[model samples]
Target: MRPVLIAGGGLAGHACALRLIEAGFEVELFELRPFFGGRACSYRLPGYGGSEIDNGQHVLLACCTALLDFYRRLGVEHWIRFHDSYYFLEPGGRLSELRPRKWAGPAALMAGFLALPIFDFRDKWAIVRGLAAVRRQAGDHRLDALSMEQWLERHAQPPRAVERFWRLILLSAANEELDRLSAYHGVRLIWLAFYGAPGAYRLGIPQVPLGSFFAEALWNRYGRLRRHVGQPVDKVLINGGRFHGFEVDRRVVEGSAGVLAVPYHRLAGLVPQLEADFSEWSCSPITNVHLWFDRPVTELPFAALLGRTIQWFFAERGGSYLKVVISASRQWRTWNREQIIQHTLEELKEYLPAVGSTTVAQAHVVKELCATFSPMPNLEARRPGPVTAIPGLFLGGDWTATGWVATMEGAVRSGYQAAEAVIRWLRADRGG
Candidate 1:
């Protein structure tokens, strides 16, 4: 049996390897990094009672079926705890909760609107109308051309409501602001969160470190597969329009097929044939300031922030560890660690007045300059599929055309799809 080569050991690559191994194929995975989990990896923080902290806080939704399925398959479904209600905290000390009701169908939908504390009568009407518009244009392609802000403005959405409420919702979900995000993507997010299930707005956070939940679980499942770490592939070796293998550390590693699962910017140099248009697929930065407080600030697991410097905050179990995720944090990316910590601490104090005079036990800053691709207009065109022009080569990354932004679920889905493509190609070649 010819071994299938997988380039890059991120979520996509690992997922593909697991699937291929299950399908009766030997696999060899090459990863540049010494560890896995890609941008979603975890690190130990000195504070937080010596608990592990993620690079940034990532929340999964009920609609994340692929990721949930992956967790279940890996036998780590219990590592995630789901919340039936989500709280949106405004800086002015106002809180809104989106809770699920037992009512079925549209009744449940109406219940969510009525239960939300952010919307008034007019705002509720506007949301209903916006949802109607979304359902009406489900099949239209023009939604991709307009930004979410433009779409809402055209519908006479109030500036205050859009800025204070709608923008926050979109930013948290899409990881991009409405002014720049595509209306289609924004609408898709709303559709999935609202219409998917009775309590679709429910949120889920990992109970354990992200690395333990994902990478370790995957390794345990496919630990015996040929694995190489700290060895980055320089380029994909092509001979006569066929992918022969790859060059790692100036040494050639030959294989029958390969999956390039590295990030976008690194792809062009590795595979010159890959015509990835990064212009449309711009990256959005995510900054997470992990703070350990002597006492808990809020009992709520996670809360959204509005009218405050802090965009979102989550309280972990070990201690009052609050993670502030500033999406599209391009400006703050280059700030020195101290400066970043100072600014974030100031913002945190403003949100939780009780922590105003309290001394910080510990603090750390984690920033991902290219955390995920901004889902802007025309981004759909920039993302390609798993199967590339090369006969024995494939692409698998969240940035691919997975219809999902740079997410764990998207990465896993891309890997699953790529593995299926490789399996189909192998079976065809054998005339099976």
Candidate 2:
């Protein structure tokens, strides 16, 4: 059997390639770059103690089963540490904790909300009502038509709760503001993470760098797996609405079927025949400031900062080095590197007083301009699935309709769905 070709070596591409090989299909994966993981990658930096730091700090929840499965396959599941509690800090150093009770249920989960001092009784009631609404109307199609902001307003959520709780979480996870994001996409994230499984909401942080998950040695084990790195495919060869091959360095590489797992921006240029309007799709940016301090900032693993540009910060390597993440950071794009570092320190001083007295360490800032696809209203209808208009051409990416918000789990799910589509098609062709 001719090895099936998969374009792009990112999460979606990697997932699709691996699934096909496991199902007894010869797979040839092509990555334009030297490494995999795409936006979720790490690189060595001079200022960062000359160590490999991730392009941005990406987090996962225990609810991300598909991503967890992918990690288990690589024997890197042990590398991720899941935190049961969430810490919140205000500008004046007031700390709050959110954790489930000894017993597991909705009430146990709501115990965290009861402990928060930021919200009033009315605000908490409104939040509870909104959450109940989400759990009740999870798969309602009308949710896709309304923005999360509009939905929250209809639920009579207080302005403070809407801003600090709903908007903050939604903006970070969905990579779009509540006003711009679909209610379905935003609420789905909250429901699945907090209310789904018992330990679903536990924050899973990779103990090692992101690139370490996809070690090159793992590829050698699968004889059916052949990865081509630093080899960019020119275009997908589609003749008469059917995938024929791929054009690589002016050479035609043939395959039985193909999975176009490239970014959403590259979709139109590769195959113009499928003329769908991609104008609704836009990119969101995320900023990560890697700061090393003379002393430890906080003993807590991580904390969310309220009413600040820096939404969250995670302590790494014994709490000396910290990675501050600002999601959907369109405003920060205009700021220079120096401005970012300075502002981050100022904010940290308010949350962690130890940071105010510390000095004499270099910093690094990583700004991913186009990190993920913005989950705009009605985007689910626009997101094409695994089966494209062309025969034997499967589309796979976080951007594709995986009923997810451009997350790692979404990427892996899209790949698995693509592989299933191809397997069904091949079986139909063989009359198996």
In terms of lDDT, the best-performing candidate is 2
Candidate 1 C-alpha lDDT tens digits along 226-305: 88878899999999998889999999888778899888888889987867657545788888888877777777788777
Position 17, candidate 1: lDDT = 85
**Residue 13 in candidate 1 has what lDDT?**
88
lDDT of 2 at 80: 92
For all candidates in order, the CA lDDT equals: 0.80, 0.86
List residue ranges in candidate 2 displaced over 4 A.
Answer: none
State the displacement of the C-alpha of residue 261, model 2, in Å, after optimal TM-score superposition.
Answer: 0.7
- lDDT for model 1: 0.80
